[model samples]
Target chain A: MTTVPVRPPLVRSSDRIIAGVCAGLAEHLGWPVRMVRIGMAVAALAGGAGLVFYGWLWIMVPTADESAKRNARRPASPIAPAVSIAPAVSMPPNQSAAVGPSLWSDAYSPGYPSGPVAPPLGGPAAAGPVGYSSAANPAPSGPYVAGAPSQAEGTAAVPGTGAWFRVRNMRYGKEILLGAGLLLVAAILIARLLGVEVPLGTLIPAAAILGGAAIAWMQLDETRRAGLVDKTKADQAGGWARLAAGLALVVAGVLVMVSGSGSWEQTWLALLASVAVLGGVALVLLPWGLKFWRDLETERAGRVRETERAEIAAHLHDSVLQTLALIQRRAANEHDVVRLARAQERELRGWLFRDPARDAGQLSDRIKAAAAEVEDGLGNAVDVVSVGDTAMTDRHEALVQASREAMLNASRHGGGPVSVYLEVSDGGAEVFVKDRGSGFELHTVPADRLGVRESIIGRMKRHGGSAEINSSPDGTEVRLKLPAAAEDNGEGKS
Target chain B: MSTPALDGTAGDPGRTVRVVIVDDHAIFRSGLKADLDPRIEVVGEAGTVEQAIEVIGRTRPEVVLLDVHLPGGLGGGGREVIAGSAALRGTTKFLALSVSDAAEDVVAVIRAGARGYVTKTISGAEITDAVYRVAGGDAVFSPRLAGFVLDAFGTAPADIADDELDKLSARELEVMRLIARGYSYKEVAKELFISIKTVETHVSAVLRKLQLSSRHELTKWAAERRLL
Candidate 1:
């Protein structure tokens, strides 16, 4: 039987309080809105005066009202600014803050909120609502807004440029940690107001535990999003085990917190011991999680390799096989056919097998920008433009990279002015990199040219895609086509 | 006008062979058709497997020359072409024609019951030759396919060895030959008036000493060796 990925709700531990469980349980049980609050109160009462655990729950889980408001406001609010500015700035819907709601939703889940009220630890100023292509809201400083016309503002984001640092920035993990710390503080303050004993030592250890866990949670969250589909039953089981262990550690920490030393001063030592125990559990669980993650990654890598192999096989079937098959059918001169067949066979037999990597930038901005970067790098006069609104995907990125690589090669090896055009059609997207450079005949080049294989054709073929290089003394035109992912039949053919 | 009268009902005359052509490009079918003599009628042409199936059901050509890559089809769609057709068993023939001459493709297509496997680069003459061959009884594999065909059909036997059975002395070999020619071990025992176990031991020894893997292999070896 196929197992669905179980996304469990967060549970409070003395170590950390992530409101995720209340939300998850709320979601799972289809409970009425206030059920989590009632459940928390009952749990606190049952667990004996609920001093530590109640505080943990209060801090860990977000208020149900907030979650409901966030959910309701999601589709309506965050997208307005991005959508309004999209046409004006010429930014695609994909690259813009159209994803704001989802990103914010994930970030601001009760367990980890990066709102103004719950700043990440060290309290970096929260990113204000951003405008596209504005001076202050340049690609670096501003949230990516889909369909926002970005002209010179986008130029700064080219790699190696001063503005490029913003594009390369990856601080979401840190932001999540800070959010967790803020939640813990808020929880402790609330507990004090509720007339609970506030011990510095207990707070310190609890804070430490929370801080480390929040950091790990953020990184793990990123990793999970990156490619952590449970490809196998064993890995799925590992995920379940990790969740169990995390839950267990949290429970143990709570037990220590509620046990409350004979006096308020001793509470600090208890908190420290509790933290050490929880931290030790997490540390022990770390290797297992990593092991499962690595296994999943390896399985993914293997799948990708298999896909590449299948692609090459298909390409060979298409190019070399078809070419030879054509020659076989039409060759009037048997000797010529034999010679051509042999030559083709040798070429195919030579590179028959191949072994086979990210990321968001709008299709247009990325293509033109990539073209400009290559042109700048190679000192070649090049013109790059997008023909239409292209939905961004790794395949499109690959096509652009291929075109850029081709342009670079033409400029360096072939040597001259290059023209790049990015067009999106119903079939797929194509990046045509043409150059009036010192063009080499296809036969003159070595059979296995790195640029031709890796930068041009290899990238396209990885996605069940295709490419063609036509060159004479006049110029070279590299037509790179990335097949639509929806068109991906999920397996390699040849 | 003497057209060679298509007289013989080769096999299952009532059944129509369902075929699906799975090339991403369309131009190939016409060219392949022209090069391939008019003997085999074209049924349906699909740029991908989905279309191939729709066409297969519609036209139901006896043989499908499936391409490895058709844009929106499953990977290894050559397999899909064969396996998808419910009527493939003992009825339809699949001929995989693609640009790849990889050993894997050859193995895959064959495993998928492509009676014939050839690359897209195969000459029109050879393709016609392949079509006719597949239309007949024999499987038409490309010259490059020789290795794969050998590998697919000639795996090492897993069970008992003939040589081990051959451990019996020369007398046992004679007894085994007699048993193989329809003399049961009991009959041999009765005829030779030896105990059944002794006969059994001799037969077992003979089978072991022959270095054969199975009784079938021993028979085959004996037949090939002309001992039978």
Candidate 2:
């Protein structure tokens, strides 16, 4: 059987006259609604403080609608995975027995119906239930069917009870501490007015303990949350809470040091004592803060390295690995292998060192460079004549490589004088490698030859352009053209 | 009834089909010339698109064996030669010869008013037959390249949305279709029976109406819409 998820406590909109506070408390504490009402009435008869408490609860406890809205607005945490619920089959039969008297007593009452056992507090299971129940019930009345708090309501009630030790619970903790401190101070002032003496030493230590506890609680929460020690709600501490707690600690430390001193004349000693006390408290807190800082730095560096590694892997897969696979399939002889190796080397070197982002140099300059390289390598006399200076930075490498291949083929096969012509137009850039050589029939070109196929034609096609080879007994000409813009139209014919 | 020989080749002078070979490759041209039957006389030859236009204009060959990718003709290839020599369109037929069988290459040349396209891999006898078929005013293409022509030109041009064509006037629309199908300005003028200057004005108007930058883009746009 599927386990029913526990839901958060929310004020019942349907069950209350003034406010849903009594119904919400009754549901959350598992006490009968009638019993909670009787208790509240008795407290109200004794003094009007119960009414004030009820008023505070009404304001603090969100209505069902408000809780639902809050749950919807909360952003999903990137680092936190969705909490998973454990099956109810493994749950101990007496699990409800461990719940405190505040709510557990109602579970075992002879007259009471056996309700669903409340989820174990402050565990991953508790977090799971709140989120799950909200998702399971699209309407507010669905939670009432189960006689349990709605998912949003459960999350709302966590800070007041189940999640009291959680860092996020401190939002309400500060108010409670402030209220208690105010009551204590009022009691002392009233006693003094009634002619009773209040000792300064006793008051100072109490204030110190309260101040130190607040500061220490905040510091410990920061460290524990930073370490993700319990993995229970990693809620961030509010900026104001930290600031207020820090101020309280400083004030309490100074006051205690000054009051404990016997003479006002020894001002330096008292000041030094306050500083020493503050230093001791800070020393106790430093290790956790230091660990958090170091962990954050290491995590950031690791993420950067991971991103860089992924980029490199993608680039290699797209280019080098593909070429290697093709080479393995097509290599027939030593000559074919050598040609493939040279091509691979050129491609690898370009990928490693060429700045693709930089603007491609002039078309004329590229042609000249290609021609000069061919002449120097092959000892061929090449005359280069360039007419335009169009820059094609995007496909610059492809065009240059194609032109270089054309030049290499000419120098290798052509008879005598070779001429390279470069022209740039609005449509595209064109480079012509013309040689006065005995031209061979295109169809007669052996399949083993990689010079014309892979080097010239394939390069241009890869760059979204075309190559034209025209050869006759008069001379051979290779016209390499690159389109001005590369528009990928989803046809992989290239 | 014997006709005067066009190039003074011996044997069956009266029955000879005078032809010009317009390929940039000299060795291929020589091989093709040596392989052709004596009945097919070689009248003139040119290497570049400009030279092809000049020679074919002067020779007035019955068939021109044109290479699709010739340089030096206003940045256009074999299409430019057909465009430049518009007056000879009626008397002379063009049969494109190229190494590429790519659909774009086949479609571009055919749309430019070539009578046929044959890859260089075709046997000499097959090329000879294609030339004769083109000279007879019947369209011809290698078996593989025929699909490209059918896909491009055989379809009804009405596949494009009405809104894309609504802005263009009748004359502008006609010019746009031809130009987008890869015909140069001169060829479009010749085909439409308008002057080249008039074709230019209509083309620019169409370009403005359709917001196309160039003929290359226009061809791609038209091809994408299956209007060609």
**Candidate with the greatest TM-score versus the true structure:** 1
lDDT of 1 at A309: 46
TM-score of chain B of each: 0.56, 0.62
lDDT of each: 0.50, 0.58
TM-score of 2: 0.27
**TM-score of every candidate relative to the true structure:** 0.30, 0.27
Best by lDDT: 2
lDDT of 1 by residue, B2-88 (tens): 000111123233333334566877798778777764555666778877777777767766677878655555665767766777664
Model 2 lDDT vs. the true structure?
0.58
Per-residue lDDT tens digits for candidate 2, residues A460-494, read 99888899998877568888888677452211211
